[model samples]
Target chain A: MRCEKSGRIEVSNLCKRFHKAGKDPLQVLQNCTLTIEPGKLNVLIGPSGCGKSTLANILAGYDSPDSGEITIDGSPLKGPGTDRLMVFQETALWPWMTVMENVIFGPTVRGEMSKKEAREEATRILELVGLQDFKDKYPAQLSGGMQRRAELARALINRPKVMIMDEPFRGLDDLTRELMQEYYLKIFEKTNCTTLFITTELEEAIFLADRILIMTFLPGRIKTIIDVDLPRPRNYHVLTSKKYLQIKAEALEYLIEEGRKCFGEDCNIANTMVDEFRRQADNRH
Target chain B: MNIYFVLPLFVILSFIFFIFYRQQKRLAHYSGISTLSQIKKTLTSQRFWLVILGFVLTIGFWYAAVYWLPFDAFHRLPGPDEVVIEWLSRDPYYGISIYTKEYYVHILYSTYRATVSFLLATILGVPFGLLMGWSRRFYEYSFPLVEMIRPIPPLAWVPLSILMLPGVEPAVIFVTFLVAFFVTTLNTLLGVQSIDQAYFRAALCLGASSKEILYDVVIPGSLPYIFTGLQISMGAAWFSLVAGEMIAAQYGLGYLIWQGYSLVKYPTIIIGMVTLGFIGYGSSAVIRYVGKRLMAWREQELGGLGVTYEE
Candidate 1:
């Protein structure tokens, strides 16, 4: 499929600070610059609380950066618009609405499509996400993986120019998570939508990205960008490939250094606990 | 019976029955049982028998208290049998019973006043509360005044309401509305505030206008709380209505009770109290049924895993 020329997101010199009462302001993001090319799956990997989500929120237009220039298709971004939709870390499907209603909400509310047309499109998208049979079910009725799929369907039905996924599969069980990742990869490949996916999982980042943007510990900025030359239409087999392992090792090294910096003294205590457990197991043997 | 009065009464009763029947059918549909089967199941359940046993025990206790208590006050109070007998009499000693037009008039007047006050409170209070929760500017400007006034009990406003309002009916209604209004407003405001921030962000990202957010996100998000508020407001309306009627009105259950007391007709007082309890219970049940119908999505949360019908 030929990718559309639109949906280029260029975020430059982004800075954000969070104010706390009776304390100094916390700088969450500083001098962050990245470009998400059209129809590419760009993944951002960072340590927890390293402001990766802050950058995603700014890009999605939920929160504003203190000083930054964010442009979509060469036009400066304003507040939230239909052109960019975010899939939240936690399921953001409207619990009161069924999967069908949730998916059709954007188009119907914006008057971009008639209710009949929106429902038809929503049915297709729900089918794409394997939620067609569950269209009338509420978000509360769905399992975590299913809810994420419904959320994806909701965003996809909008045909958003840029799709932002913030740890969308964070809470699913291991098997379900792996299944969802594969399912999501197939959808992404088919649509070839421009996407900026945020994750703390190195494996997930390497497996799904066309390019991986590694973020620094705090006052988060792009530490480095690793281009993934893996062929498209990939699967679980790619996880064991020679190139995948090399990329994972390099990404893990960077993440470990950043993780050490982020954890500081706490990291030493965790290591000590692990050492103690190993010693106890050796004595038992 | 007057045709004019009886016709309206028959129409209203049939309307209420129609709604009740439809609600039962819908509830059964959701539960995957027919209405008749559900009713049969409830009747056969141990819980139903336990409820009956509870009522019997309570009445038995009331009988024991009335007959055996040695206190002068206990002697002055009418027994359960005496009240029940008077309530059913065609020509009773207290001049109020099933056959009496005056008894129905009192019940109708009380019901009318409570319904009007509750409706008025809901119509005015929901929007006020939504604005208070939605806008910081509105909250800052009006919340303090609401707080200041809410602390004053509805009964405390009886004297002032009578003075300011044109007549006794308005005064009674005003007092009742105050209590219901405050309850509805506060609950609705809290309801709006309790919504997840992510839902708002999602709505914004979908390019929803402010008005769209208000309708699509704010209203539905707060419905559970709004319904809860309505139930409480309905109760408060009746509470304040009786108090207001006792002081200012010529006809109502409260007026009937006060009249019975002044006339030393103890059975009449018991009759009025029992009637009030039944009507109040009925009104609350109606509100609950309506709330459940509207918030069908919340059923799984409320009823838990057992009630969920998996496809």
Candidate 2:
């Protein structure tokens, strides 16, 4: 079900710093190199306050890195463009536009298609997101889940080469978030657009990623990369499978160790998760 | 009862028709209610009843107070009935009287000045303010001048305006326009500034050009503020119009008020005051109506309140 049109992304030693007028410079990202294969879902998971968001912003061309480069389809990115659309953590669907208007905004703005073609594309995407009924509703009029779906519809309509989702389901209730993760997997399978999905949730990463990148907090660094070899044509039922649990356990181990290092003993996930990682790391040593 | 009340009554009548028309439009989709019942429903609503009661009780109290109070007491603010009676009679000292064409002429000139000035302020200020908000350089360039000029009262411009402008009409309009224009420009600027940065970022990532962002993000995003500015501008126009006309106008509601005061005709002044009230209320109401129409998304956000007849 992978798409033929998906594009590869290369992040080479990306570094970014935030300088304050009267304060010491803060390093948000440093030496962060990652590769998201074409036609694959690469989930980047990290702890809160990690520089994942900064990296995502840099990749999306919303912000420039102090140093290093991001290339899509082997070409250096110029700036924010339709070719690389970023679905924001918060619902970024224009409240002023109805769902239909939000979906077609990219094509219309880019003059990428004829009027009839744009309409057809909008209809197809809205239907793909199961939002045809609510296409005329304002983002305010929609439920949280529907708004997320609408935002996804808005992003996918542009056929972005590298779809960078910044915790796209972070704010949803647990049930809806899980449902959205499944829904996104369905869309990802179809589009197969090289995705650099950022999240703080381990299971969400396990649920959607072909490869998972665990990042350190603050001066964000990719500490570990685990290939989720769990069988595809996947669903929530796979949560009970041994392979899924093993992968989840491995991700938790790395996340817990990184969480402990960055947050000291303060992180609850580290408190709960590091014992297992300690045992694993201790046994390895 | 008198001809002076005619225009005010006409305004109220049109206001009532507007309410009824809006109600009818909403009810058109409801199959359960007959058209007659829908009219009854609209008239009998709590808001409608409250409005009617408010007007009736206030007017009734004013009539009683004016009638019973001795002319010596409270310096004799004339009653509605006296204003109505004087409005009908032909005595220039006691009443404007239906026979006088002066009342209509004053009203016509005042309206013309206020309307022209108001239109000019709106056409000039809104875009300038929006640009100021949209672009940092524009804001930095113009904001200082706007701030420096904003505090100068419209009345303070009178002598300088009279000397600079060719005619009294233009001078008065200049003063009125200053007030409306300042309110409009500032509010439009606030509207643009109030827009969340996320909206601009979203627009940029979606491949919108700067022009498209202005149309889709900056403008529509700032509409609630724009309309609010317009409404405040409407009020400021009427406010400065009275002051402007009182200073230099040959004829206007402001002139009537001034002429009445100089001539010791309290009833004529009250009529002019009441006319000004009606005009201010009607203009703001029109602006609110237009705001409601342009901002359906806002209406949806605020749970459809203020945008509908019903809660």
Residue B191 in model 2: lDDT: 91
Interface RMSD (Å), every candidate: 2.8, 5.5
The local distance difference test score of each candidate is: 0.87, 0.83
List the pairs of residues colliding in candidate 2: none
| Residue range A130-167, candidate 1, lDDT tens digits | 88898998888877888899989888888888899999
Summarize candidate 2's per-residue lDDT along B104-161 as a digit string, tens digits: 8887888888889889999999998998997889899999999999999999999899
**Which one is best on lDDT?**
1
RMSD of each: 5.5, 4.2
Q: Compared with the true structure, what per-residue lDDT tens digits does model 1 show for residues B250-307?
A: 9999999999999998899998999999899999999998987888788855555323
| CA lDDT, candidate 1, residue B233 | 97
- List of clashing residue pairs for candidate 1: none
